[model samples]
Target: MEVKQNNLIKSLRIQPLIVVIRLENNFFNISDKRENLLLKIEKLSNCGIKNIEIGWDSNPEWVNLILQIKKKFKSINIGVASITSRQSLDSIRSLDINYSMSPYFNKEIHLKAIKYNQLVIPGISNIENFKEAINLGYKIVKIYPASKLGVKFINELQGFKKKDMFFIGAGGIKSKNLKSLLKLGYDALVIGKELRNQKPDKDLKIWLKNC
Candidate 1:
């Protein structure tokens, strides 16, 4: 399948609250609860979650499922996991997704993914990764450990680069920090295990209120 981006720049302009894909392959027994969990996801969407993500770690079925889920949520925006193929975009190209991001953007596979109109976002830290990502033409940069770096880190980063280069902090984010992170001028950030854990909608409401 070939991916063609329609209004790609417009879609990328939004402030994203991405929930990364997490398969509970250990500890928690989710095998018998797929349907219920899917229901929960649907409910979350209904409750106004416009930004979401699917972390497909070499799984076509997962990508297909995410497509199906998207069919039901016409108003939502979705993104795929990071691409780190040593050979570049080979593996990511096959997924045919809207966006592809990762802790690293090795050549080849990444180039191929870009050809398909995938919005590539590479994880970066310090001057080296930032320069490399910009050189590679990735407008979005995921700041791996946002919690540790906080506002100070981003301020330091903007000093050297253009502020419009969509910056996202995803490693250790929580609902409590969303507003603060936003205030820091970060384009977006991911809520890690916080969203993965089962919690009541009321709790989510309270968290959002505080945020």
Candidate 2:
């Protein structure tokens, strides 16, 4: 299904927590690793996580796994991240992913996703990149390395030019500061490392209850 921007906006407005799983480079090491990851996704889904982005790697096996999950789950929005090359697009085209995410604000990638009728979100690291993305008609954007940029930087942009702009805070965001970042006006939060490393199901239950 081709996901529209308005539909994505509505979904985000209702559920703003985006769990980003950075697939370990050594994911294939464990036996039944594919099932393990899918089980993790099931736990997250049962906890009411409506959105998830598989980031960090874009291997074919991972792409196939996404397709399999998408077929089984009817409610979740599955997205593939780190789409920077045409080869990446071709590799996962059959997956029919709900959306695409990038770690950089590249016009080529953005346009390519659009051409494929997919909702695309670009990551912006600075005011300049943010401006360029907004000018290109991207309403939803991810603020990468939020920890480095600090809450003060976000507060300063409260009166941004684009009133409809929505920001997803990612990179170095942990359980300790997730609530604070959400309160600071980040439309959504992308969590990793801290939330998924040990006992993700237990952590997600506690974290989401507070949200």
Candidate 3:
């Protein structure tokens, strides 16, 4: 687990941008939605995006979709997001995904992940949760709703950060603010709706190229 965790951190440090995709049940048919997602992932891959995280779903086919993605996009590192419950944790225990993330810290979930040997990065929004996460032996944590918390929150938390700890900024992150956040000390940033709402825009294209 240590080796795998180290490798994941290294990969994210190198690219520093994780494209998150959430498939919601909506008006569109599931087949069409899945196809569109695949196309978007292909586009991201072409643009040099190396890390991708798909939200967990209750649908039975969600497992199949993840497997299909792994087989199709062998070069991209895949992870699961929004892993907030034991059911969700069980869903990916055998999938052997690169990593998984929770929207907030849950001690029960974190302990279960350790017992299962799954690398589930906990999301933290307060200093208390941050400390708890560190005590739980997690070196990687997600600062959720990062835009809402702003750079100052991270800057203040720097005092509590241990050596080798990594922070992934997620929620409400836009291409325009990505670099600034990274510069402010986030190890990486997760871009979701803004990036998936359309094809990569000029700013994103340039950032990907530079990355």
Per-model TM-score on C-alpha atoms: 0.78, 0.86, 0.95
Model 1 lDDT vs. the true structure? 0.62
TM-score of candidate 2 on Cα atoms, chains taken together: 0.86
Taking the tens digit of each residue's C-alpha lDDT, what string does model 2 give over 103-168?
Answer: 778888777777776666888877787777777777888888788888876775555647877888
Worst 10-residue lDDT window, candidate 2: 196-205
User: Candidate 3 lDDT, tens digit per residue, 76-161?
Assistant: 99999999998999999879898989999999999999888899898889999999988988888899889899888898778899
Winning candidate number (TM-score): 3
Better of 2 and 3 by lDDT: 3
Clashing pairs in 1: 82-101, 82-102, 88-109, 88-110, 89-108, 89-109, 89-110, 90-109
Candidate 2, position 186, lDDT: 93
What TM value does model 3 have? 0.95
Residue range with the least summed lDDT across 10 consecutive positions in model 3: 23-32
Model 3, 90: alpha-carbon shift in Å?
Answer: 0.3
The C-alpha stretches of model 2 lying farther than 4 A from their native spots are 1-3, 26-31, 56-58, 201-203
Give the C-alpha miss distance for residue 44 in model 3, angstroms: 0.8
